[model samples]
Target chain A: MKIKADTTVCIGAGMCALTLPEVFDQSEDEGTVVLLRETAPEGQEEAVRRAVTLCPSGAISAS
Target chain B: MSDLTLPMTRQRPFDPPDEAAELRQRASMHRLTYADGHVGWLVTGYAEARAVLAHPGFSNLAEKMHPPIPSRLDLVEERSRRGVPRGFFLRTDPPEHTRYRKLLTGQFTVRRMKALEPRIHEITNSCLDDMEAAGGPADLVEAFALPIPSLVICELLGVPYEDRGQFQEDSKLLVNLETKADDVIAALGRVTAYLHGLIQRKRKEPADDLLSGLIEGGELDDEELTGVGFLLLVAGHETTANMLGLGTYALLTNPDQLAAMRDDPSVVDNGVEELLRYLSIIHLGPFRVATEDVEIAGNLIKEGEMVGVHVPVANRDPSRFPDGDRLDLARPTGGHLAFGHGIHQCLGQQLARAEMRIAYPALLRRLPGLRLAVTPEEVPMRSDMTIYGVHRLPVTW
Candidate 1:
C-alpha cells in the first residue's frame, strides 16, 4: 500500500499522526503531514486507512 | 412552543437551560422568535445540527441578519459586509471562506501544535506558580485559566504580550451582549487600528510567528490581514479559556470524575473531549440562513429563514450520546460538535485540544488539593455573553 499527503490542503487537525504515528509524522514547523513510509508497514494498513478518513482536510490518501 | 427563543439563559451554569432541554426533547427543530421579532428555526438535535452546518443550503451569511443578540445588529452588519472590516470567515460561506482558511491551514496543523506542546506546559506551570505565590483564594479566571491561553495566543500571533490588557478589554466589549453600540464600535475601531499598525510592522520585519507568516505569504492585503489577526486573537484565547474555567467547575462539582482524572493518567485525553461536549462553551452555535428551501428531519425550512444550532442541547441529545446528560470521562466522545463541523468547524481546535490535554493534568498534579473557593451558586457564569463560562473561578489549593 502507498500513502500520500497533500501538504497544501492539510489543515493539521492532527488526526493522521495521532492515529498512525508509525506510518505518518507531521512537520514541526508547517504542521502538515510528513509521510514516514511510502508503503504501509505490513500490519498497519487498517490504521493508515483510518487516518486518511479522519483527516478533516482530505489531505491523505492510501491505495 | 412555536415562539421559542434561542439560548434560554441557564439558571444552572453546568446544564442546558430548562426551555432548551424541553425543546430538544420535543423535536429536533422548532420555529423560533428572535429578539428582533424575526422568525426562524432552532435546531436542537445532534444529527440535524450537523446536517445544517454541513449543508450548502444553509448559509453563514445569516449572522448579519439574525445575530443572536438584539443590540448587536448594526455592529454585525458592519462586520459582515463584503470588503471593509469583514467579520471572520465564521460568517462567510464556501468559496470565500475556503480561500481565507487555505491561507492559514498550514500554520495550525496538528504537528505544528505538538511542537508547541512544551511551551504550553511551561506556560501552564508558570500560571500555577503565580497562583501559588498569590496564596489561597485566587480567581482562576484572572490568574490561570485566562492567562495561559492569552499568553500563548499572543506569542503565536506576534501580538506583543504587554498589549494584552488593552486587547482583552476591547475583546470583552466586542463579545459582551449588553455592551453599548458606541462602546462596541469604539473598541472595534481601536482593535482595527492596532492590528493595521502591527500588520504593517510585520510587512517590514517578518518574524517567526503566524502573523509574520501570513504577511510573507502575499495572498492577503492589509484589511484581510487585519480581519484574520483580529479574529485569531479574540477566538484563540476566549473559547478555550472558558472551557478551562467551566470544565474545572464541572469536575470539582462532580467529584468522581475529578478523582478519576486525578488518579488515572490515561483519562486526560478523553476527559477533555467530555468536558468540551458537556460544556459546549460556544452555546449559541453559529447561525445560518437557508439560502434555499430544504427539508431537515421532516421539517421544511424555507429560503431566507434563519436557523441556529443550540450546541449544548444537541450535544446532550440522548439519542446520540448514551446517558448523554451525564458527564462520563470514560466514554468515547467522538463526533461532538464542540469544535463544530463542516468547513467552518474550527481553525484552532487541535491547538485548543493540545492546550487542554497539557494544562489539565499539570494543574491537577501541581495543585492536588485544588477546590472551589466559594459555593457553586456564588460563582458568576457568563450566560449573557456570547460564550458560556464562569466570570470568575475562585479556587483554593
Candidate 2:
C-alpha cells in the first residue's frame, strides 16, 4: 500500500494523527495535515488505511 | 406488583470526598452498597459499573425518581413526565437511541470534524492571543476552554454569538451540581425558553446553523429541538471546556509527556487520547436506572435500582485497559472509555477529539518555552464538582 495525503483539502480533524500517527501528523498552529511519510513504511499500511476509512472529511486515501 | 418475581429496591451511594480517583477506587474496590426506601438496587463495583452501563434491563424511562432530586420536587414522588418527545436521543435505549442518533451521526464524521478544524484552531489561537494581551493572570477556564467550544457549538447550532453570554451563564449554572437541584431545573427551563426564542427566530428567518437546519428541515419537533439543543449547548460546551482546562493542567504537570509532545508534535494525538482517558471530566457521568432485575458479574441488581456510570473508573479498569491505572501515552489504547460506549455514547466526540488534538499541540507549540506559573500542588484544581476542571490554570512563557 502507498500513503498519499492531500493537505490542501485536509481539514485537520486529526483522526489520521490519532490512528496512523506514524504516517500523518497535524500542524498544531492550524490543524493542517502534515505528512510524516508519503509511502507506506513497512507494516504501516493497515494503520494508514484505517486512517483513511476513519477520515471524516474523506480527505485521505491509501493506495 | 412488588412480588417474589421481582426483588426489592436498593440504592447505592457513589459520590466521594476530596479525591475522585479514590472515590472511583472505593466504588470499584469495596462491597460498598446503600439501600434507600424508594430508589432501586444500586451497583458500585467495576464489573457492575460496566454492567449498569450496558444492561438493557436498566430503564431510562422510570418517570418518578423515588428519592426525588431536591426539595421543591420533594413530594413530587416521580422526577417528571416526558413533556418532550418520549425518547429523545440521549434518554432512549438501543433502537430509539440508535434511531434518534442517526439524525446527527453523520454530523460528527471525520469530514465534518475537518470542516470545523479551522474554526476550532481560530477559536483557540484567538483566545490565547487575548490571554496573552491580558498579561499574566487569567483563568484558562474562562478565557480558553469556555469560549472555544461555546463559540463552536454556537456556530454549529446557529446561536447568535453575542447572545452567548446569557445562555452560557444558563449552561454554567445548569451544570453546577452545588446549585440546588431545583435551581438547576429552573435554569434548564430558562434555557428551553431561550431555545424557544431561537426556534422562533429560526422559524422566521432560516439561517445556516444546526437549529435552523433542523427547524427548516422539520426533522424534529419543538420539544425534540429543545432537548437536543439543550443537550448540545451543555454537553457540547462544558464537557470539552473542562477537558481543555484539566488537560492543560495534566500536560503542564507531566513534564516528561510535555517535553515529549513539544519535541515531536506527532505525540499530540496519542497525548490527547491518554489525557482524555486519564482526566475525563464527567465523573458523575451516564446516569441510569435498572428496568428489571438483572445479574451482572455475579451480583443480582434488583429492578429499578439507580446507578452512575463512571467513565474514569471504567477507563482505569485493568481488565479492559492494560496498565489502565496509569497515564501512559504509549499504552496501546485501541478504545478508551473517554467518549463512552453503546448508543448513548457522546455525539460530539469527534468534534471534542478534534478540538483537543488541535488545542494541546497549539498551546504547547505556541509557548514552547511555557512553564507552570505555580507548583502543581499549588495550582487550583476542582475535585468537588461533577465536572472536573481547574478553576484557573496559571502559566507563563
Candidate 3:
C-alpha cells in the first residue's frame, strides 16, 4: 500500500509517528507528518492503516 | 424534548454518570437543555462525538458556543463579549485557531516529547523518592501525583517552581464549576499578569525553555505571549496530575489490572491509553456550536445551536469499546477522545502521554505494596471541577 500525507492540514498530533514510527516521522521544523516511506513495508500494512485512521486531522492516508 | 440536564452526578466514582449510558442507548445524539435556557444537542455516542469534533460545520468560537451546565454561563457570556484572548486558540476556529496552534505544534511533536522521556523519568523518580522519604499513608495527590507534572511544566515553561503555590491555587479556582464569575475573573487576571511579567523578564534574558523558545519565535506580542503562557501553565499541569492520581486509584482498586501492568512492562504503552480512556479525566467535552445546519448521527442540528460532546460517556460507548465500563489495561484503546480530536486536539498530548508512560510504571515499581489508605468512599473527588479526578487520594505502600 502506498501512503500519502498532506502537511498543510496536519496539526501534528503525531498519532502516525507514535503508532508506526518506522513509516512516519514528524518534521522538526513544523512537526508536520513526514512520510518515511512511500509504500507500506510488507507485514506492516495493518499498522499503516491504523496510523491513517488515527490521524486526527485526516492528514494521512493509504491506498 | 428530554429534560435531562448535562453532567448528571456520578453514582460510582470510576464510572461516568449512569444517565449518560442510558442516553447513549436511546440515541447517539439527544436534545440537551443548557443552563441558559438554550436547548442544544448532546453527542453521547462515540461516533457522534468524533463527528461533531471533526466536522467543519461545528465551531468553537466563543460567540457561537454555550456551556453545557448553568454554572459556566456567566463566564461564557463574559468571554464571548470580550472575545477570546489573543493566542487562546481553544475558543477560536481556523484559520485563527490554525495560526496559534501552528506556532506551538513543533514544540510538542512525538519525537520532541520522546526526547523528554529521560527527564520525565528523572522527575518521576524524584517525586517517588520524596514520597518514600515521607513514609507511607500519605496523600498521593499532594506528594506524587501533583508534583511530577507541576515540576515538569514549570521547568518547561521556565517558571519558578517556587511559585507553584500561587498558580496551583489560581488554576484550581479557574476549573471549579462553583467558582463565582468575579473570583474566576480575578484568578484569570492574576495568572495573566504573572505570565506577562515573566515574558518581559524572558525578553531581557532568554532561557532554554518552551516559553523562551516561543519568545524567540517572535510571532506573538506581549498580550499574545501571556495568553499562550496562561494556556500551557494551567492546562499542562492540572490535567496530567489528575490522570496520575485517579489512574493510580483505578489500578489499586483493580488488583488484576495492577498486577498485569506490574508484571509485564510491554503493556505500559497500551495500558496508559486504556487508563486515559477509562478515566477520561475531562468530564465536560469540548463545547462547540453549529456554524451551519448539520446532520450528526442522522439527527438534524440547526445552525447556531450548541453541542457538547459528553466525552466520558463517548469514551465508554460500547459500540466503540466493547465492555466499555470495564478497565482492562490490555484493551485496544486507540482513537479515544480523552485528548479530543481534529485540529483542536490537545497540543500537549504527546507530552502528556510521555509523562504518563514514564510516571505510572515508575510509581508502581517504587511502591510495590501500594494501595489506598482510606476506604474507597472516603477519598474526595473533584466532581465540581471541569476536570474530574480525586481531590485527595490517601494511599500507603
Candidate 4:
C-alpha cells in the first residue's frame, strides 16, 4: 500500500506516528505528519490502514 | 423528529443513556429539542458524529450554539460573551481557532509526549506509593486517579502542584452543569487571575515548562497566556482524572478484561483505546452551529441551527463497533472519538494518552488485590457534571 500525508491539513494529533513510527514521524517544529516512506513495508499494511483511519483530520490516506 | 431531550438518562453507569441508544437505532440524526424549546439536530451515529465534527460548514462559536440541556445554558452564555478572552480557542472557529491551536500543537506531538512517558511513570508510581501507604480503604479518586494527571499536568505547565486544591475546586465549579452563571464567572475569574499571576512570576524567573516555553515564543500577550494556561490546567487534569478513576472501576468490575490487560503487556496500548471508547466520558458532546445549509447522513441541518453530537452513543454505534455494548480490551479501537474528531479534536490528547498508558498498567501491577470498598451503585456518579465519571471511587486492595 502507498501512503500520502498532507501536512497542510494535518492538525498534528500524532495518530500516525504513534501507530506506526517507522512509516510516520511528526515534524519537531510544527508536529505536522512527516511521511517516512511512501509504501508500507511488508506485514505493516494493516497498521498503515489503521493509522489512516485513526487520523482525526483525514490528513493521511492510503491506496 | 424525536421527542427525546438531549443528555438522556443513563440507565447503566457503563453504558450510554438508553434513550440515546434507541435514537441511534432509529436514525443517525434526529431533530432534538433543546431545554429552551429550541429545535436542534442531534447526531448519534458514529459516522454522523464524525461527519458533523469534521464538517467545515459547522461553527464552534459558542454564541451561535444552544445548549442541549438547561443547566448548561449559563456555561454557553459565559463562554459566548463578547470578546471571549483571548486564547480560549475551543469555543472559536478557524482561522482564530487555528491560530491558537497551532501554537500549542508542536508541544503535544507524539514524540514529545512519548518523551514525557518516563515522567508519567514516575508520577503514577508515586501516587500508587501514597495510596499503598495510606492503606486500601481509600477513595481511589482522591488518592490515585486525581493526583497522577494533576501532578503530571502541573509539572508540565510549571504550575505549582501545591496549588492544585485551589484550581481543582475552581475547575469543578466551572465544569459542573448546575453551577450558576455568577458562580461560573467567579470561578473563571479566580482561575484566570491565578494564571495571570503565575505568568508574571514566570516572566521574572523563567522555568523549563510548557508555560515558560509559550512565554519564550513571545506570541501570546498576558491575557492570552493566562487563557492558554487556564485551558491546559483545567483540561489537563479533570478529563484524565475522571478517565483514570472511572477506567479503574471498569477494570475491577470486568475482571476478565482487566486480567487480559495484566497478563499481556502488549494490550496496554489497545486497552487504553478500548477503555476510552467504552467509557466515552465526555457525556456532553461538542456543540456546533451550521455555518450554512448542510446535509449529513440524509438529514438537513439549516444555517443558524444548532447541532449536538451524542458522543457516548456515537462511540457505541453498532454499525461502527460490532458488539458495541461490550467492553472488549483487545478490540481494535482505532477510530474512537473519545478525544473527539476533526480540527478542534482535543489538544491535550497525546499527553492524556501517555499518562493513561502508564497509569492503568501500573495500578494493576501495583495493586493486585484492588476491589471496590462500596457497592458499585453506591459510588456517586458525575451525571450532574459536564464530564461524566465517578465522583468518588472507594476501593480496598
RMSD of 1: 3.0
Whichever of 2 and 4 has more DockQ, that candidate is 4
> Model 4 TM-score?
0.97
Best by DockQ: 3
lDDT per residue as tens, model 4, B1-397:
4676885578888898888888889889888888767888888999989999999998987678776888877666666674456788787788887778778889899899989988888888888889888887999999988998888889989999988888999999988878998898888899999999999999999999989999999999999999889888989878999999999999998999999777788999899999999999997767889999999977889998899998998999989899989999998788999999999898889998988888898888888998999988899999888899999999998
Q: Which scores better on lDDT, 1 or 3?
A: 3
Q: What's model 4's lDDT at A45?
A: 99
When sorted by lDDT, best at the front, the candidate numbers are 3, 4, 1, 2
Q: Kindly report the fnat of each predicted structure, to 2 decimals.
A: 0.38, 0.00, 0.75, 0.66
Give the DockQ-based CAPRI class for model 4.
medium
lDDT of 1 by residue, A1-63 (tens): 999888766655667777888887777655567898899999989888878756655788999
- Give the least accurate 10-residue stretch of model 4 chain B, judged by summed lDDT: B75-84
Candidate 1: give the clashing pairs.
Answer: A12-B109, A12-B110
Candidate no. 2 TM-score: 0.76
lDDT of 4 by residue, A1-63 (tens): 889988878888888998999999988877889999999999999999989988988999999
Best by lDDT: 3
- TM-score computed on alpha carbons, candidate 3: 0.98
Cα deviation of B172 in candidate 1 (Å)? 1.2
Query: Per-residue CA lDDT of candidate 2, range B168-271, in tens?
Result: 78776755545665666677778888988888878999988778877876767887887778778878877888888887777676788877766777677777
